[model samples]
Target: MLEQGRLGTRQLTTLTFMMVVGDMMLIYPSVITSYAKQDSWICAFIGVPLGMALMAMILKLCSMHPEKNLVQMARSILGFWPGTFFSCFYLFFFIIGASTHTREVGDFMTTQIFQYTPIRIIILMFVIVIGWGVWHGLETMGRSSELLMPVVIVFIVVLAVCLLPQVDTSNLKPVSDTGVVSISQGILVSIIYPIGEVVPIMMILPYAAKQAHQTRDMLIAAGLGSLILATLVTISLLVLGAFLTQHNIYASFVLSQKISIGSFFERIEAIMASSWMISTYFKAMIYLYAFIVGCAELFKLKQYRMLVLPASILVFGLANLVSPSITFIVITVVPYWVDWDTTLGIILPGCLLLIQWLKSYRKSSVTPNNSQQ
Candidate 1:
């Protein structure tokens, strides 16, 4: 069993918000723009409901066995063999996801900030910081997020305000030229990338403080985070225009580069970069924490921290090996990541909830007959 940790509703909210908004800073606007053109913000708006629906399903599963995390609940509802198998799959999924995140940080730094620095050095430095955070445990991570997320938000709002003078509302004109099919594709990508990926948050839910309502807290956080992302998308579309936004790999970073508040406050991309780094660190730490906790529970280990170092090492190695080029990562995340995340995040958990409901209904019906006898 995973040890119970007391994560307050506020901490959980910040953590969820940070996790969903972090990586979206780097990749989301560009990809969504590619699909929806000037109407990319619409994709983000449409995705919110789908994301909430997925969260509702995972929350239902958690409600069925509030005492157990996703891994343990899987074992309980599916029997040992199948449960272990699925739990291992989740571990692998988190590990790969974490690795990709690590690589993304390295890629961003190497391309935009440290062009001459070795990618491996960037990845190692990032993973080391993340390892330290994971080692400190969930309460520490939660508290850290609670403190840092507000600062990140402040920076984002400041950056947006500073760039307001540069925004061209006409850039967002002629909306939906991409038609319904393309807009739907953008919506799917939006849901998968940040919103639907909240599935992994299920691993942390069981550790929340006793009085906390995990489902309500997560749903609210997810909604708020999605709104923030949609707003950012609208800002990116207005400022960068669809053609520039779609082509740039780091659209937000490029947008930040455009900020020049009367020539005195130029080169504000550093602030945006700092915000991305902090938020991405929180995301990597959360994913790493989940992976370690899941592995410990899978094997019934005494402590999850014991696996942290080896896992970090594994993640570091895989980060380097995952793709030879940043373009490959971007090219694959759309169809590939959407499919992968939808299966694990939505379908599998939804199935578990359905099965658990059926089992409960049958048990209740049988109990009445037995009592009558």
Candidate 2:
């Protein structure tokens, strides 16, 4: 079992918010606007409830098996071989997810700030820091998030305020110009990439110090995170407009570049980048921690910290191999990646819940028969 009393509800909430927002904060505006046009904010709104439902499902599973994390629960409920298979699958999912986050951090730094720096160097530097956080365990990661999240929030608010003068409310007009089909597509993408990514919280939920109302806390965190994403999307639409948002890969970064206050507070994209880097680091750390813990559980190892280095090495290699280019990443995200996540996030967990329920029902029926006999 995970070390108890290591995390409180507040830390878990902050971690969830950071994980859900993750790299999506930088790129989602552009991706959603490409599909939903000026109504990308609407996609965020639509995705909120769906995101909550997904979170609730994962929380229910965690609540059912409070003493065990997802990997352990799978093993106990699904028997040895089958459980090991699913656990390994989840491990792979987290590794791939973490690698993508790693690549995203490198891509942003290389393209936006350090034009001459090699991407591999950026990836190495980031992985080392992330690996350090994971090696110390979840408490360190949680505390780091608690300290950094406020700064991130402040930077985001400042960026929004600075860009207010540039906002064109008319840019958000003709809201449904893309029609229902396109807007629906955007909503699905929004939920899948950012909101639905909260599935990994299942692994962390068992570690919370206060577990009495964890489900409620998780939903609130996820809802608040979605709301924040919606606010950023709205800001992006108003300031950058739909056309520019769709064309720019890092729309929020581009939005930050537009921030200026009497020319003295100009070029504040560095601040924006820093906030994004913080969010991405926490995001990657959560995924990396999950991957490490899951592997330890799968192999029945007592210490997960030992796996951190090898895992980081594997993730670094995969980050470069899996994402050859941003276009390829985008192409895969919509069709293949989202669907795969849905299977692990919803379908597999749902199946496990059903099996667990059946087992309980059978046990109850059997007990009644034995008493009668």
Candidate 3:
């Protein structure tokens, strides 16, 4: 392992917590509402347990491999070529995830927040900062997550409380009318978007100081983060209603607009933007870190830092070219992106777990037969 820093348990939990809350903060409610309408909060209620169960499976796979990160374990367990292909699959997933997320921030910033700035410039600057952070390495990002988590928590509480006056409880009244099918679809989407996204943490799990409580720590963090997200969804549905929540790409951003205490606390949507910005920062940094680590491990490089600058350049270029426009992503890309996230997040790790179990079973069976012979 080129990276030797150990993350404290708090740092590990913070990273897992951020995984569930990060970029999903702005878009999760909208996607869920689009699928389940008035029952979006119900979908959230259902998805948390499923997501935690998925986390447990990922943890089991990691434990089976001891200290090996995902890339190393893939090669070791699946054999050289198969593991190499698997490793490449994850590498692509990481860079593409980082690129797409950077594009999102660029689009939001240029169209909504900084209309005067060019998208390319905004993306370039964001990539530079993320690269700088990744260059400093895992420990710094771990600490940064712990620092940013409270900001996210406060932003959620503030948005929910301040928007209470505008919240129309009736907006959620037509619930369950969306039915099991739609709610199930919404749960699937929400599970993968932010909740299942914790699969990337496998890349850095070994960097954390191993604790017997690692599983508990992650589950608690994931549960807490999902609770925060579900609260955001409920608030959005109550305040913005299903139609507006579904139509608005930044539903939480729009929800923050309705926060009016004494009618004077208006236009402070900066709270939403800043909270989201903090989350997006973590998402991009972790994905980029994984991409760099995966590449070095794949090629047997001496150090991962050598790839950081060049990878940032590639990420910036890809961010600009990710889609024809933000509308394309909103309408055409997202439906497919959810499935892709699940493939990387759940299916891949699940396969790793299965393959390792098969190998262990074979070894035990063979030993028993050889002893009898």
lDDT of each: 0.85, 0.84, 0.88
Steric collisions counted per model: 0, 0, 0
Please give, for residues 1-373, the per-residue lDDT of candidate 2 as tens digits. 6443388887888899898888888888887787889999899888888888877877777777887888889988899889888888888888988998999888888888898999999999999999999888788788889899988888878877888888889999996888989988888877777766776777887787865676687688888778778888999999878898888889888888887787788888888888899999999888888898888888878778789899999989988988777777767764587678668876898899999989989999999999999
- What lDDT is reached at residue 23 by model 3? 84
Count backbone overlaps in model 2. 0
Task: Score candidate 3 by TM-score against the native.
Answer: 0.97
Judging by TM-score, tell me the better candidate of 1 and 3. 3
lDDT of 1 by residue, 220-305 (tens): 88887787788888889989899888989898888888888767988888888999999888888888888999989888898888
Q: Look at candidate 2 and tell me the lDDT of residue 106.
A: 85
Scored by lDDT, the top model is: 3
Look at candidate 1 and give me any clashing residue pairs. Answer: none
Per-candidate TM-scores read: 0.96, 0.94, 0.97
Candidate 3 per-residue lDDT over residues 168-205, each given as its tens digit: 89999876998778888899986787677777798998
List where candidate 3 sits over 4 angstroms from the true fold.
Answer: none
